[model samples]
Each structure stands twice: as C-alpha cells, then as structure tokens.
Target: MPLPLHHLRAGIIGTGFIAPVHIEALKRLGVQVTAISGSTKGTQALAEQWGTPEVYGDYDYQSLINSPNVDVVHITSPNRVHVEQSLAALAAGKHVVCEKPLGMTTEETAKVVAAAAASDRVFAVNYLCRFYPAILQMRAMVQRGELGRIIHVQGHFFQDWLLKDTDYNWRVLSSEGGKLRAVGDIGTHWIDAVSFILGARAKSVFATLETFHKTRYRPTGEVQTFTSQSDPASMVPYEVDTEDFGSVLLKFGQADHGHVSGTHANCAISQVAAGWKCSLYVGIYGTKGSVQWEFQQPNEIQAGYRDQPNQVLTRNTAGFDKDVANFTDNPGGHAEGFPDGHKMHYRAVYEHIASGKSTPVLYATADDGHYEVKLCEAILRSSEKQTWVGV
Candidate 1:
C-alpha cells in the first residue's frame, strides 16, 4: 500500500522567510515536519515554534537529509547552496522540493536534473504561483481555445522592499544570489506562471538590465530577508553588482494545445518600484478576448470581450470552479492568496507522492526549473549584448 501523505515526513533546510512559509503550509496539509535545519541562532526556535522534533543547526543539512524521520527534503536555503543540498538529498533517497532558480546557473542545475532523472524520487521546483486558482482557470481557457489564438502577454513583477540604498539582503550581491537579482529572485515566478498558463516555453529573449544603486550600505552583520536594520551608524558600504530592474521581451514556442503558438511576451521586472509591495500583474490578449489578473488581487480574474459583456470570474464560482476544483478549499467569498498558493502547491506535490506518483504533474519539474535558469542566463547575455539571445 502507498504511504499516507501525512505519514511522509518533511525536513526543511532553511530558516529564512520562505522556510517558515513552507513549514506553515506543510502543517496545514497534515504532513509531519520532523526536522528543521539552519543557523544555530534561529533553527531551534523555529523548530520549537512549528513543533518539529529534529533540529540540525549550523547549516548541517547533510545530517538532516540522512535522518530516518525525514522522507522528503525541502531546500529553502540561499541560492548558492541549492544544488549541493538537492544533490545530497537525492543521493540519500529522499524526494526534494527545491526553491526556484534551482541553482546559481544552468551548469549546476543540469547536474541536479540528471540526478533527479536517475533516481526514482520525486523532485519539484517551488514555482508556487502556478497553483493560484485564477492561473489554473486561465490555463484551462487557453487550452480549450476559449481565449482564441494567442496574441501577446504583458506584465510586471514589482516590489519595493529593496527600494532604498540602505535596504540590504544577500540577494543584492551577485556573488550571493547569482547574476540577475530582480529577474532571478521574483521575475522567474512571473515567467514560470506565464509558461504554465500558456503551455509553452520561451525560446529566445531580448533584455535590458540596470542597477539603480551602484553602491549600497549594508549592516556589518547578516540580516534575514525583509528584516530592517536599526542602526545607521553600524552600516558599511559595498558596490552592488546585481540588477535592480530589467525589461525583457520573449518569443515563446508552440504549445501542443492548438490555440497557442508563437506567442509574444514582454515583462518589466523591478525591485525599486515604490508603493507596490508585491504586485505581479499579467494580461493575456488573444484574437477572441483577453484575461487579466494580479497577485495583489488573487481571488478573481477579469475576462474581456470585444463585442460581448466582460466578466469578473471569482474563485470557486461559475467559470472558475471546473478548472481549479482540486486546488482550492475555501468557499467563493473567502480570500485565498499567497499562503494558500503555497498550501495548494504542497498539497499537489504531497498527493502525488502519496499516490505513488500516479497524479498528474502540475508542479514544475527539474527540467522546468533548469530551463528557467537557462532563461535567466539568456536574459543576462541579452542585456549585455543588447540583442536577442536564444535560451
């Protein structure tokens, strides 16, 4: 008999902002979060807060991977260590759900792809934005030719958390977070969601990247993501190498679904956009109609028509229920946004594992993750050369 989803235990490998989100979602799914690993200062506290039994502090993820209590490994660590930890977990016969970008570059992520392919274990990349009910509904419409022949897509993923020069995170440094900061950190979420909805991959890219702050101040000691530094006197200055903003144009290949072929897309990615906390807005236009949705308002999608009346489709309601019934739990009026996206994503992944891999793969796979990294590399190259670059 296949194991129950709740019986398959999870081990988390980071204690940053995203790590707790993973823990909360897993707990909501009734999965046993048995182990937590990260810096010694906060690992135990996080474990205690979540009621996880095993704690591997001082970044000792190898020990956590080898733990008998852990059946699945969730790599939420910094970008630099994702490949190393993922490779280790796969070797130890554990399923993996890694945070996106997969690795710093395509070269390292390719190794992970090979490792995941060689093993029977399930490997997923945390492109959780795909689980949003509105996204799924849009995808179903596109596949069913409800959107008609695809024309183009335009959107922007903007955030203001890192807007100021004193706003510092490890992600601001190229050496720490890889080359593309705004694009890699949050823009990939937008790109992956678009690909998932359109049922296609970006074939080539033309991009322009800029660093608004050539030099920024950082605290002498490390700070967790989204946390503020109190003392300006204790700050030190460093040169910023990663981009603060990017504009990218993409040409996507044909989807097996007859309605979508050779779609054009453009996206503006930025970390310096003031007043927008975390807004990912996407508008898909086609020959028949158009659909628009934003991350800030996740519960509904606006469907536009040329001659007929436009419609506001709400989650769990008519026109939206059929496509995303399995992913959403709340009733029509109740709001489910960011946290719920993570919950639904883990639910899909966990159900697949519990069913002996019989469930359809809605989650992003190792190859999908690797392709996103390749896209990032292409974006960087295109920005440098000021021309189109194939992914």
Candidate 2:
C-alpha cells in the first residue's frame, strides 16, 4: 500500500535556482508550500516572494522538516547535503522529493535508499524529463514491442552555458560540485531518460571526460547559470577540477522482464558545445523500426519502419498510447516544453501519494536515483581507468 496524502503541504529546504521550479510544479498540483529554508543568508524575502508564510534559515532545516504544517519535504539543496537532509526528513516520517543526482556518489545514494526502504515514506527524485509526452510515447512503443528488439541507442545532452572561459558557478569547483560536473549535472539526465525510455539498464560503461578550461573567471557578485558577466575586475580566476565534457559507451543488459537484451549505445554530453543550447537528442534503433525524439522539438516523435515510410506522432492523437494522450495537456498542435514536464512529474507524484498506489507510468524514486548514481560512478571509473567498467 502507498502512503495516503492529504493537503499535500510541502516544506522546501533550499532556495536556489531550482526552488522556484519545485514551488511552481507543486502549486500546479495545488500543493501548499508551508515553509521555506534557505542558506545562512536566508530571510522572509523568498517565502514572502513565493507567498510561503514560514521561513527558516540554514540552522533550522530540521525545524522545517519537523514542522507539523509540512506533510512533505522538498530537498533542493546542493548535492553534498542530499543524503543527510533526505534521511532526516524520512526519519521524521515525512515524504520527500529531492533534486537530481540524488547524491554525490553511489555510496551516499545507497544510504538514502536504505533509509527509504526502512521508512514508510514516499520518496521521489526529480528526473522530470521522463514526463515528456513524446518520451512516454517512445517508452510505450518500445514496451509494446512496436520498436522490435532495441539494438542501439544514441543521444547527447548539449548546452552552451559553460562554453566561454568566463563562465563560473558552484558546479565548476570540486569542493562544491563533485569531481564530475558535466556528467553529474546533465549527463545523468541523458543516461536516466534513455534508460527509462528503452526499459533497460546500463551493464557496462566505457567513457572519457574532459576539462577544457583549466581556469575560469569566478564572479564576485551573484550570477545565474547560462548568463555571462564580462567585468574582468569583478571576477577572479579560479582553477577548474571537474569535467566540462564527457562521452560514454554503454552496453545495456537485458531488461528485468527479459526485453531489450544486450543492446549497445553511446552518449555525448557537454556543457561547452559551441552553438547548441539544451539540445537533448535521443534515438533508439530496433530491428523492425526506429524512433527519434529531441527536447528542442518536444511535441513530436519521428518513427521509421523497415517496410514503410517514416511517420510522425504528435501529442493528443489516437495514434499515441492512452497514457501519452492523457499526459498531453493541449490539443495536437499545442507544444509543451520543459516546464510542462515538471508539472506532469509533480502531478504523478501527488496522484500517487493521494491514491496510495503506484501508477503504470514511471516517476523516478530513490531506487532509480540510486541506480543513476551507480551509473555515474561507473562512468567516472571508466574515464579514469580508460577501461570498461561494469555498472
């Protein structure tokens, strides 16, 4: 039995870039954000700005988790604190929704997984890209054997945010970010989304990671991601320890249900791609047919068959799976992008909590997030050793 939800009140523990996203998604589901806890510099400003009444500072995170007003906790803090914070929330008997890369390493993630198993709490990881309508359609096609034995998968997650040497963030430093930046940050999404769509897990990984800029300009003032500041005097040069780009060769094992066996694929992930911006392009090739979906073109999927011409499937159409159709918020021609994906993901989370049952569609859980951390560890090992590492 699943945990029953009432009121769906959330206590958010971080006020970083992703906090508003979580707030907006939860609001879409009519979930109340009862409290907000920010860094040491925290104030009532964020809470007031978001219309959440209660505000807690860094030291009072426990107060937020233990607050009776908060039925759930959203851990949106940095990666280093995820395990401790999530475990605390679970121990307090509160359901939790955590931001991605659930932990900095596999061991850290496993600790949370163990805690989640021992507790009767709803735990979710924000792999919101899985909620895309086209992604759901692709998964259904592969699941129903419409794609026929999936032989290969290919994709890349590219963004130009860190293309310039002036780009800097907490993500560029190893002390704050983990040793693998690009791979841990965006590569996890590519790996998770591809594995989810294909219904397969990576068995082995062979990879390489590159840190292009040895030093980057760190801004003395606050700067948001993907935005650049050019004042040389206001920025200081800092050495980079994490990778900016990575490529991984993946050999996928047989699915748990014995489908998609022995498939192989490759993914190229980068934060320094010159012109591409948030282009997550994925294609799955099967013996009978092939399917392609790109994040930039979120509303449609391109399908090709051995015996017929290529076809395009759009949202809200009879040709798509019923689940896919249901996920599509607008008519056939209306396009839904990243924000919609987050909303649908939150919808699934709230619905599951409300019904006390898991749905047919996938929403990333502690276990799924743990598996991704394992994959990231393998990728890091493969990159360091220059040898294939088993996942």
Candidate 3:
C-alpha cells in the first residue's frame, strides 16, 4: 500500500523562477511547503504568497534545513552552492530534491554522492524531463523490444530568452552557473532523458561549443530568469565566458536490456535560437521503428515504421499503455506540459519517501547527477581539444 504524501513537509531554498515551480508542484501533491529560504528581498514575499510559516532570508538555508517542520529540502539555489546545501540537508537527516548539474565540479559532486550513499534518506536531482509520459512510454517500448535494437538518437533544446546582448540572467556567467551554460542548464535534460529512454549512459562525447555574444550587458542589480530589462543606461558590459550554443555527439554504452548497446546520439543545444522558447526535441530510431517527441507538443509522439504507416500516439490513448499511465494525470486531449512534468516528478519523489523507499527509483539519483556534471566537464574538454573525451 502507498502512504499519504501529505505527511512529508518540504522546505525550499531559493526564490528564483524555479523555486515557485517546486513549491507549486509540492502543493499539488498535497505536500506541505513549510519553509522558504533565499535572498532577503524575495523570501518573505514568496512565503507570504504561499502562506508558508517559516522564512529564512539572506540565503540562510542552514536554518531551513535544521527546522523540525521540514522533512524534505529542495535546493533550488545557484549552481555554486548546491554541494554545500546538499551536504547540510543530508546531515540534518532531511530528504533532498536538488536542482540539477549537482555542483560546479565532479570533485565536489562526488562528495554529495558519498554523503547520499552513507545516509538512509531519499535524495533526488530535479531532472524532471524523465517524468514526461511520452518519454516514459518510449522507455517502456525500448525495454519491451518494441523499438528493436536502438540505432541513433537526435534532438535539440533551444531557447531565445538570451538572444539579445541586453538579455541577461545569472546563468550567462560561468561563475554563477557552471563553465558550460546552455549545456549545463538545459542540454543535460536532453541527455538525461535520452539515457533514461535507452537505459544506457553515454561513454564518450565529442562537442563543439560557441559563444555568439562575446560581450553582453547586464543590469547593475540581479533580475529573475526570463525577466526583461531593456534600458541600456542601466546595464554594464562584461565579457561572456560561457557558450551560448553547442552541438554534442555521444556514444552510449550497453544497457541491461538487450536492445541497446554502443548507440550513437547527437544533440544541438542553444539559448540564442530566435523565437524558440524552451523547446526540447528527442527522436530515437531503431531497427523496428522510431519515436519522436517535442516539448512544445507534449501530448503526442510520432512513431515511424518502415513497413507500415507511421502513427501519432497521444497520451492517455490506445498507444500509451498502463506503464506510463501512473505518470500522467489528465485524460486524452487535455494538454499537460512543463508544470505537469514537475508535479509528476515530485509525486514520484514524495511517494518514495512516504513509502519508506519501497517505490521504484524512477527519479535521478545522486550518482546520476554526479555523472552529468562529470559529463559536462568532459564536454568542455572535448570542445576545447576538438576530440572525443571519455565520460
């Protein structure tokens, strides 16, 4: 029997765009969001907005972690502090659902892996792309040999939020985000989702990265992601160190399922692609057939076959089987996109915690998160050296 998710109380650290996403998703799952910690400017307002009782301002996440009211901690802070906050949350015996890329470096992320391994708590990385029903259905098909002997995968994650020289966010800086901006921020979602569907990990990577805007302007004060500041007088110019766009080629290793081994995959990731907003596309081709999905059109997938006519499989319909039904809430024709993915992801995590870790581990673990960071480092090296680097 499954336990009630309402019993788990969550505390969130960070007041950025993704923080409210975490809060709203937890609420939808009947989980109480008791505490919120972040900058003094936004923490109290955010708490009041959600009627949360405890507010830890000035980025004081330690207090939030120590609070008896919080059973789980959601680390949505910037990339640099993920490790410190995660370690603190673990030591406090709090279950954690941290935002991705784990940390800035593999060395620091390894500590989180070790810490999570030593603890009995449930730790998850917010790679919520795995929760999409289409992705889940595709994984089921691959595992069942419906898509026989996976051949190659192709996709791209593109956005125009950072297209202009004046458009700025903390992610544009290597110091605030990681060394790789577009890849680390969104590209990993593509890679992780593909890995989940294929039941394999990328063994090596060949990447080419480019920074389109050599110099970009930012406002004197910090602004939330996707927020616009158009006045040139209020901005100052700085040299951009991170890539605005990149193309990556990956060679995946064997999966436990006999269908896939040594598969080839390529992806294009960009934050500067004009008019495209949060578009993530994935196509997996196999000997038997192929499945294609786009984030913009989350409700259906295009399944291609050589011998027969291709079909469009919509969620909660005939082609989507019982395996993916649990991940989706709405019926056929009702559109569920980005926010629903977050909700389902949190539902899976909270259920695992509520059920005493008896539920299937569908969410990304600490080790998976660590591997992504390591892969990001390898991608950076590969881009610089113009050669394939082993992950």
Candidate 4:
C-alpha cells in the first residue's frame, strides 16, 4: 500500500560544502538526487560532481520547490538565507530539513515553526549530533533519572580557521551572519547538544563575547576564498563585527522549577580556540555524580557517579537505553562519524515524508531550530546588555 523508498525524490537547494554530504547520504538511502539548485557556476559544477543530472544554473528556488519531481527540499543556504529558503519550501507544501539557526533571529524562527505547523508537512533541523548512538545513551540515562537530578550542564566548541588573517569567508561578515560570531556559528552546537541530551532547555545566560582581532587585511581586494590555500594578500581590510571568542554561564533549571524555568535555562558557545575541528564537549552534573561526552570522540560516552568507577559507554553497549540502542547499525567499536549522522537524519526525514507523519523522537524539529535561534538571540542580548537574559 506504500511506495518504496527508491521512488522518492529529494531536491537540494545549496551545493555548498554541507550540501554534498546531504546528497551523498540521500544517495546511500537510494533516494534520487532529483534536482540541484544553485546561483553560482562553481556550485553548479559541484552538483555534477555527485552525478546529479539536473542542474538549474540560475535555479528558481520556488520553482524547484513546487515541482512534482521533488518530494523534499533540503536547505543548506548560508546564514542569512536559511529562514527565507525554508519558508519557501514550507509554502510549497514540501517537507524541509534545514540547517541550524533556522533564522537569523529567534522571532523569525517562530515564523518557520508557525509555517511548519500550518502546513502539516514534515520538518526537521540538521542538529543530528544527538542522533549519535553514544550521546543518545547519555540522554536516556538522564531521561530515566538514572543519573539522578541534573545539577549543571556545560558545553564548548572551538575552531581556529577564523584566527587566520588571510583566510576570510562570508562567515566573518556581520551582515552575512549575525553578530555573535564564534558562538553563533560554533557555540550553538554547544547549546543544542547539551539541551538535546539533558532534555532540558536553557533559561538564562550570563555571557561575554569578544572580537580579538579588530581588523583583518586581504592583499587582493574583492576575492572569494576556496582551496585549502588562501592567498595571503587577498584580504583587503575588513572590520570584525562579531565575537571571535565567546563564553556563557548557562543555567538550565530542573523539572521541578516548572516547565518555564527548565525550558528556559543557561547555555553557551565560543570560537577562536586552537585544535578544535568542530569539537563539541558536554558535561552534565547530576545528583548522584556526573556524565560527560564530546563530539570528537563521538562514539564513546564517559559517565561517572558517586563512589563508583567511571564507566565508558560505547555504541551498542549494555548500559545504553533501549530508545538509544535502536539507532546503532554497527556493533560496538565500529565508529560512526559525521556522514553517518547525516545519513541517519536523512533516512528519518525520508520516512517522515513517505509515511506522512511527525515525530517527537527529537530529530531537531522546526521548533527546536527556532528555539536555538532564540537562545542565540538571548546570548547576544546578555552579552550586549552586560546582564543575564532570559530565553
């Protein structure tokens, strides 16, 4: 009575670095990469790289969205474009899987959520880190109260690419991405990862954001950077508008604080630290003791409790909760990384479109994305106002 998965078609709107990964993951699931849309010739070429046949050089986003050939639209557009593009897909009545910070502002994020609710179309955000088998185990422990009541939560993400003066991209521009800088791009992960795991929301944040480099230079003016090698001279001069280093003191209240307090809590993110290649670390202090995990060592979850030796929970290990255990395709010790998370998320979204259903399974819904943006906004407010701000 249902159509087979291979019959479904997915259209990808951006051919940026992240888009290809989504395309490949879809291909692995046997979903047709029906259409590729991009404004740049460079991106169009990228579409062909993946063996996708259809290329709309000056792609009409709305046209591709409403086309009968496409069943789902994946939005991998840059920071400024995420909200508009996702809204377009929702307007067309197609399902959507948008990247994080679904909107530049939390208010805009609410619009996306409203759109999702009105359409009855499936919607998911690309916060797939939670889908990892290891983190899922830690979440289950918190959910079952196995770790006792959560006392405190901490998360951090670091990157050094922005620290290079010669290497410049649109990410550094305030007009392109909002002003939160390192925290907006990388710190949001810290917020999302902890919130997802503890199944708690951040209420308020006491934060400070800084831009260490007041200005940067490009030897060659008006050039886009690609290639692992960036021309030292190309950086003309750009004033930094966002914070390169940021830290936040967050308080995500317990269940008894009333949903309002727990749902709105403290969280933070930062950039400009060294040796972090998208590393996400999370520490949750619970009544009995604590639980810890990090994204770099993705497959392993470290946990500790009162008077007990710390335990290492691997994917598919005995202590894993049944809900988390269901996601492990490979047995213990066979690692799953970035692509695997994307693959799992794609598979879940595909199932949603085919079955015509919504899931509370915490695959980062539009609601989650909107909430993240709001959290980011609150972080900015707290940092700017020099006071703790409520989410």
Candidate numbers sorted by TM-score from highest down: 3, 1, 2, 4
lDDT by residue (tens digit), candidate 2, 1-391: 3233347899999877788888887786678889999765643667878788888985578999989999889988878888899999999999889998798888788999999999878899999889999898888888888888888999999999898888777778776667789989999898888889878889999999999998888878656556787666778988889999989999988885454988999999999999999999999999889999999999888999889899998877778748675466778777788888988887777777776655653789999999988988899899999999999
- In angstroms, give how far residue 261 of model 4 lies from its true place: 6.9
Worst 10 residues of 4 by lDDT: 256-265
Full candidate order by lDDT, most accurate first: 3, 1, 2, 4
By the lDDT metric, which is better: model 1 or model 3? 3
Query: What's the lDDT for candidate 3?
Result: 0.95
Measured by TM-score, how close is model 3 to the native structure? 0.99
Itemize residue pairs with steric clashes in candidate 3: none
lDDT of 4: 0.74
Q: By TM-score, who's the top model here?
A: 3
Candidate topping lDDT: 3
Model 1 residue pairs with clashes: none
Candidate 4 wrong stretches, greater than 4 Å? 1-4, 218-231, 254-268
Candidate achieving higher lDDT, 1 or 4: 1
Please provide, for model 3 over 1-391, each residue's C-alpha lDDT reduced to its tens digit, 9 standing for 90 to 100.
4357888899999999999999999998899999999998799999999999999998889999999999999999999999999999999999999999899999999999999999999999999999999999999999999989999999999999999999999999989898999999999999999999999999999999999999999999898998878877889999999999999999999999989999999999999999999999999999999999999999899999999999999999997957786788888999998899999999999989887888899999999999999999999999999999999
TM-score for candidate 2, please give it. 0.95
lDDT of 4 at 214: 85
